[model samples]
Target: MLWRRRAGMNGESDLAIHGATPGENIDESVRALACARHLPQPHLDRWLAMNERSRAAFLEIAQTLRLRTGQITAALELLEEISVRDATDCADILAAPEIARIRLHAGSAPARARELIETLRARRFPRLRETSTRLAGAIRELRLPRGISVVLPRELRSDVLTITVEVARVAELDGAIEALAARRAAIARIIEMLGGSE
Candidate 1:
């Protein structure tokens, strides 16, 4: 009496309720939550497959943290990856000090939820955070004109850099261009980092 994901001909997942036995009450609650949140069956199955402590810990988090479906899915994925990498359980990962602080953070539920996912992401990919921080510091050191901005590639997945200038007058555009030219050498270093020369 649960939902499971079935890969279809197109290699996409199809959701349907299937039969499995576990802690009946927890399973039922998981099913109810899954249906209510429109959680995909694969995620639901993953949730149910957890040990009782882990399942209960996550369910508690889902309720008290007021997580939405997408957040839950993201949290589930991060938790699994962290668990595998650290050789720990989801319950332990969720209860880590950093996450515990976020859980008790006084911000709005949505803010805390977002921070939780980002914190998990930072923990899962520590080097990415460090690299992003370094890149940001490099940009700050340039101290270019106010309107000019260097856009980092999303998740550092691409080496492309986008520079934009906002100006209301020809004089302002001229100033921005001159400022960009002044910082050309430093900007090239940023490009080198983005190109994985770090």
Candidate 2:
């Protein structure tokens, strides 16, 4: 037997129970966890144990709930940190009842605990992730022999770059200047690739 709370078109919630074989129970339970507005603890635990898809669905529902409750910024940030794998196997995170429990225990503002479960979802998109990785690698490869540190512009915008060069005397200053001069073309190319005009 599996139990779920269903919301009707009239905005009322009803307890829906299904009695069936174990496999059927699991399916019904997963469905309930995916759609239910409120999750009872025991049922949440059962839903967490079902399978990967069910856990992912539960996390999605939890995210929706957070958004509807005006935790938009926090929810967006949390989405960046949450992964489907964490949603499936990590009971302390992406588990609705557990999140609610943590919320109560921490006495923090809404969506505070959820931040801990956030995964870098931007890295999941192949093109964006690939571009970011390539850009970072290219930047690292431009390291100067004098240990000049190149700071990437925030958001990779390429408008402003900060280069740190350590020099203790006049001779080192000349070397640093020459090193930077040598790398000027490479740096310009990198900036162009990042969508900035030299």
Candidate 3:
């Protein structure tokens, strides 16, 4: 019956019963140990033996609890870093709206608009490369298009070459923003669970 009761307590309950609630329990247990110092050796030995299985179970539970807690903490820290980086990227995008607007404006002369578009494309190349690399790695195991082409001006005309690369670039930027938002949300949830905040 004692063994059955011990088994029913599982591991976490044993730790709780051992008074491992934080700082108070440790000090309490220390005082208890000092008082027990005067007890007979045989009685102490038998008591420890009787609690051996409970101790083992509690140790296992403590290890797992610490490991999971550490993992969650690390993950939250990483997400915070990602959120900051993503916010910086978003700020860059926000500051560069003029570039995309210039590319989209139909009244802008083709040569001038083309120059602005080319500049925007060059500026975005590094970010696009990073995003594409991640996407490529994710899709490597599946069969998909190796590359996609978008028509400029979105209108088909042999004489008038109207193709805006900015559209695709903007889409990629939006996707990156969305990805960051999702990561931030996930991090927020973990932080809430761990009793932290943004």
Candidate 4:
């Protein structure tokens, strides 16, 4: 399909998708970029399926952020899911504070790209994000001594809590053990939270 854009009343440029008929002044700019990046056909189809504003918005993001193939795919899927769940537009999703901060503000592009995906994931899974936040707060509340770490399962996908102690000496190890024991009740609360105990 041919891609073009026009200015919206809000000053936002909107993308145009045209049928792939012969001699229609096709706009291959976006398609060329997608091809250069080796974007998978299925994902490319998904991209093409998005509305004009979303297509333009995502195109701007993909270009500006230098999103890799995998990142593009993940971001697209997350955006699609978020739109379906929230009944919102992809452009609106990209405009969110957390996303816009990373997109419009600056740091490493790779880091921002990763953050963009993660931010979208958080949006897509609000409850999981909330649970993760609460669990992280609980972990911080423990105030375990240095060299001791509380590890929660990735995404809290399972009811597993891993406690690690790093000590260079028997004395340090003993102190770590003591510190953990002192925080046993607090730590248990964290474990209970992980186990869906509330």
Report how far off residue 140 is in candidate 1 (Å).
1.9
Superposition TM-score, candidate 1 onto the true structure: 0.80
RMSD of each: 10.1, 12.7, 26.4, 4.1
Model 1, 62: alpha-carbon shift in Å? Answer: 0.7
- Residues 52-158, candidate 2, lDDT per residue (tens digit)? 54344444344334433223334323433344534423333343444444333444433543443333233234454566677678778887776577777765655
Q: What digit string (tens of lDDT, one per residue) describes model 4 on residues 1-198?
A: 355656566444445556664222222545776798898888888877877667777887787678998999998899999999999989898867677677666598898888888888888999999999999999998888889999999988889899999999999999998999999999989988898888
lDDT (Cα, tens digit) per residue for candidate 3, span 1-55? 0111132221212233443443344334423442444434443332233233323
Predictions in order: lDDT: 0.81, 0.52, 0.34, 0.81
Estimated TM-score for each candidate? 0.80, 0.42, 0.15, 0.80
Q: Name the better of 1 and 4 by lDDT.
A: 1
Model 2 global lDDT (CA atoms, 0 to 1): 0.52
Kindly give the number of clashing pairs for every candidate.
Answer: 1, 5, 4, 0
**Number of clashing residue pairs, candidate 2:** 5
Better of 1 and 2 by lDDT: 1
Off by over 4 Å in 4: 1-27
Better of 2 and 4 by lDDT: 4
How much is 168 displaced in model 1, in angstroms? 4.6
Model 2: CA > 4 A from native: 1-120, 123-127, 196-198
